[model samples]
Target chain A: MKKLFAMLTVIALMLGLLAGCASDPKPTKPAGTQGTQAPTGGSGGTAGSEGPSEDKAPIRVGVLAPLTGTMAEFGKTYEVAMSMAAEKVNAEGGINGHELVLEFEDSKGDQNQSAELASKFADDDGIVAILGDFSSGCAMAAAPICDEEEIVLFSPTASNAAFAASSKWAFQIAGLASYEGSYAATYEVGKYAGAHDVAVFYMNTDFGASIVENFRPAAEEAGMNIVFCEGYSDTETDFSALITKAQAANPDHVLIVDQTSISNVINQIRGIGWDVPITMLGPSTSQQVIDLCGENCEDILTTVSVYYSEEDPEAYAFAQEFADRAGFGATVMAGFAYDGVIILSEAIAACGDNITRAAIRDNLAKTDGTYLTGPIKFSEDGDIIRSYLICQIVDGKYVIRCGYDYANE
Target chain B: MSKIKAFVGKHRSLMLTAALVFAIVFPLFGFKKSMVRIFCRILMYFTLAGSLNITNGYSGQTSLGHAGFYCIGAYVMAILTTRFQISFWPVLLLSGIGAAVAGLIISVPTLRLKGIYLSIITLGASEVIRIIALNWEGVTGGSFGIKDIPRPTFFGFTFDSPLKFYYLFLGVAVIFLLISYRLIHSRVGRSWMSIRENELAAKSLGVRTAPAKMMNFAYGAFWAGIIGGIYAVYVQYIDSAVFSLDEGFNIMSMIIIGGQGTLIGPIVGSIVVNGLTELLRPIGVWRFVMYAALIIVMMWFRPQGLMGESNSILAGAKIKMRKAGKTGGKKEAIS
Candidate 1:
């Protein structure tokens, strides 16, 4: 009886496995990339599908993002953002008359998965360039694959300083931790001049450590006495002990260098009745952090590249349209993803009809002046060199306190 | 056809050799670089799952911290190679030994404790290792991970490509399988099974359960460590995120879904689970859903797994026609 039951189960699983394996790899409609927000302004309804240029093959660009796993929500928004950007490109006659078609592959926020997808995307000769794999770890993991295959891996959100210099094929739109970390210390902390009673709380991960590496030197140079400095694990949620320690140190200001869980630390710090002016670096420049921390999120100064209230017509249109389409205000992730498409297009355009990965990368390095955020260009390292706007959460939204060119008094 | 069968019966060993050659060379014919890469991973899981089966399946010890040992092997490989400039071959064995040392530490509680408590200890150990990998920035590279560890080399030639790594690890996986086969069929293997069947009876029969179980844990962890080292080189990069508890469960699932205790079971299980993972790519997030559903439906129908029972044919139950006679039913042959 047990043997029979086991046989039946084996047969059932075998059938499912066979069926799943046999379903030939066709492009399934990616979750968030769909028929929403009818192609506005650029080319209303003459979308590439039923066009005279139907004979021209669509130029395929692969998007490797966390469409699943812990970063799924951000990944989905990135998909929507990428789709929006692609549509805008397609509406603008795309690159040399071939419409840009994005092939969405889920990295599942895993290193192995990201690497696998990178190889898969690279293997497909039709796929011209690859954009993103969200986190720096995923991006770095995928970088070797792209490097070996000689393809572009333009990461929109990977923020590791090591990754930029790792591979020639890799390019990061996200600010390097070194520059942003030092910039935060010199400008943000130095703005208070003397009596710098800062309590620095950093995540003990590589990303946070890299920031701390630069922040400490810059802090000392600016004569900021870091009274309470603590390196907490990534899974640390209850910051009550850390907060009490910071409070006991009698700090009048706080510096949070973290990702995602910064909100929890901020809310707990405020909850422990240790209210003070806060300075957050890098990824904290998001509306998600603001929404999560609620009232405690206000007056938190952040060095940001994706300010929604930027006084630029193009930035406003993209942000407004993206927010309306994605059902949430544009975060730095969405903004960079949107900008990544623009950067790719500019690079592809710079290739001037004979588009190749090498040409695209070469053109990418020559990206001079504002594409969306400040004066943008690639440094000697593949990282983008752009000054960030200093912003604060006022009321319930992001309010830019100073422009990218804002100098310390 | 009757004459052919008679001739084949006379030269069955030669036919088996030809079949083995065909089986080995078949994948190379359709080898896309991506497919080769995928197969390398499939082989990795195969090796890992088989090791887990040594303790989890054979001894009935549910260890939720299998990936912890995997982490040890990987981190050892990562640290030694990048920091000390050690080559891959020696590091492979060192990693296995490193993980075995970790297994020895865990076996103390695992042997003394009962059921769920043992599982909790293991789970705790796995998480602690991951946390260490995250915080121990000096050696493990913190969360940035140990980047650009050199690829495995043969003489002076680098096993840098996926196809090269696939063949290298495929041989290693087969060797592991062979070692496991020998271990399972040995007197020690019989003792492990006896312990699982009835610890009191096995103890009464002069079996030292403590030492045997400890050996079993170390043996299992040794395989996991080797595979983890291979995985580190194959992917060329690894971090704490690579060996989360989910991966521990994932390896456990492959053995469970494939047919827990049998020799060929894990090999088959790893192939199917990892293959399904790749095949279900178009489904995006729903891939895991489909995978879980298949496993659930399979378990509901057959609690013994796909090839769990000893005499099951798909379980690779070898047909030894010689010694066991015409009714070679009860005394199952090893595949």
Candidate 2:
């Protein structure tokens, strides 16, 4: 009886494994068409298509996001914002009469998984383009595969200077770290805050390293001295020792470079009763920092590639809808993701009926228009350089202190 | 099923040849490039898990830091190949020797320890290696990692695609298995097994237990390092983040599920685990939960693993015999 039971269990497990593999790839439909009927000759339909038809095949794009690891927050943001963009595109008569579909594969923020998923997407004949893998390291890992496969590897927020340059098929929408870092050092720390000696605490990753590498030369050129610089691992949570070391330097200003742990650093700095002016380079206009740090975030300075203010109706609408879905205020990272989808769809629309991988690449390379994140034009290296807005946390909210043209002034 | 197992046991050599032929021609079946990559991953892990089995399975030494040795080999190849522009063929051997040396150094301190204590020391040692790699900016590139690692070439043919790299991994895996098979059947293998059965008994029998254990560790670490070098070139990128405690645990889990103290255990483990990874891709985060549940089930039903030696000390068969003897004594007394 025990032997028979064991055999039966083995059979059941084998069946479960087969069932898991047998299921078709799950592609997310446009959010607008999930429950409601398809629009027929409506106001949104007038932009491109005559009407939404069920017979036309949907254009699919594979999205590799780290939905289950340390970077899950950013991955979820990409999922929500990209789906929102797909919904908007479909509601506006789809991309050249074909409904836009997104197949989000969770990479868990691992470079191996990212590269494997990229290969899977590249092998599929249905998928025309690939988006995301979150970090620069993961994106760079997948870059070789996408380059060899001749498929478009478009990243929403890979700011590494070497990432886009690694592959001809690779393109990133995030402003280069070199440009952002220099602007932060020269403007935020040097000119705006009038701080001479700066202590920098950056994450130990490609993104953090590149920023500091560029920040040093720019800070020195601006006549500011770097008293101390240190990097901590991404998984590190305790900032007491790091903060103490930085405090020992007794710098006039402190700059923190990281996305997930900005609030932890700020709270720790204030917890130790050190009140040096803190300016951050990453985590642009994040409400989580304010929520987590509370009063400790007061008068904290930062730079953003884009800012959605109540004064702009279009940008404000996006912010409101994003907040309703994401359960937090929208940041510039979300803006980049939303813009990424729309930009890719526009390139797809330009392909007309003969849309191949090469055609998508050609059309995307020629992208030189205004986006949700302001004017975006890919340089020869396939990344963009955008102007910045100086933002300050006042009364527990992000308030823009300078316009996009602040660097020029 | 028993009949089939008996038949296979009778013609073991024939079955082995047939399986080897199938593996060699697998990529030529016109499978998708992604599928080929999955097979490559399986073969890579086959060697990795098999190496771990040398210490944890054969010698009864529990190690949870195989990834530290793996990290050493990968970094050795990446640094030498990228910076010095050395040929990959030589670096591959150097990487293995490097990891073997690291294993020997680690074994020195852990010679007197056993079970969980040795495991804890290995775990700490793995973290120390990763921390050093992360902070050593000059040679290791700090957190930026080493990138653009050149692909290995044989004469003029570059291992550029998944199909080509599949052969490289297969070649290494086959060589490892052949050498391990010879080693496991030799007198040295008998001494290692005796130590696993009882270190005190082995020592009384004039077997050098300490050197045997150290050599076993070095042998295991050597194979891990070789595979790590292959992995560095395969991915063309090396970073400190790749070799974490989680990675060490991942390799260990394969041995647990496939069965330890057996030659074919790791191969079976690799297929089941890597196959499940692809099959469960649609399930998202729940796949990890499923994997944990599968391990729990394996432990409950077959603690020695699928291919682990059932009669070995690691399987607790001696304890079962002792209990049965005690029960029989009680029955005789009652009679």
Residue range A1-409, candidate 1, lDDT tens digits: 5455655555665576545534424443422343321222221112444331666666777888887888887787677777777777777777777677777777889889899889888877777899998888899899888989999999977888878788988998777877888888888776632338888999986678888889888988988888988899777789888888888999778899987798898889888766788889757676678788899987888888666665677878888887777677777778788778878877887787688888888888787757665556788878975577787779978777777677633
lDDT of 1 by residue, B156-238 (tens): 89988887887787788778877888888998888887776667898999999999999999999998999888888877778
| Residue pairs in collision within model 2 | none
Indicate the DockQ of the complex predicted as candidate 2: 0.34
lDDT value, residue B297 of candidate 1: 79
* Alpha-carbon local distance difference test for all models: 0.78, 0.84
Please, what are the lDDT tens digits per residue for candidate 2 over residues A1-409? 3234444654565465445434433443442332111122111122233344557877888888887878887887787778778778987878877888777777888888899999989988889999897888889889889998999999989888888888889999889998888999889888899999999999888788888999999999999999999998888999899899889989999999987788889999999899899999755468788899999999999998887888888888998888887778788888999999999999999999998999999999999999888998889878989899898989997799888888788
Model 2 docking category:
acceptable
lDDT of 1 at A312: 73
Model 2, position A265, has a per-residue lDDT of: 90
TM-score of each predicted structure versus truth: 0.90, 0.93
Candidate 2 segments exceeding 4 Å error: A1-51, B317-335
TM-score of the first chain of model 1: 0.88
Chain A TM-score of model 2 versus the true structure? 0.90
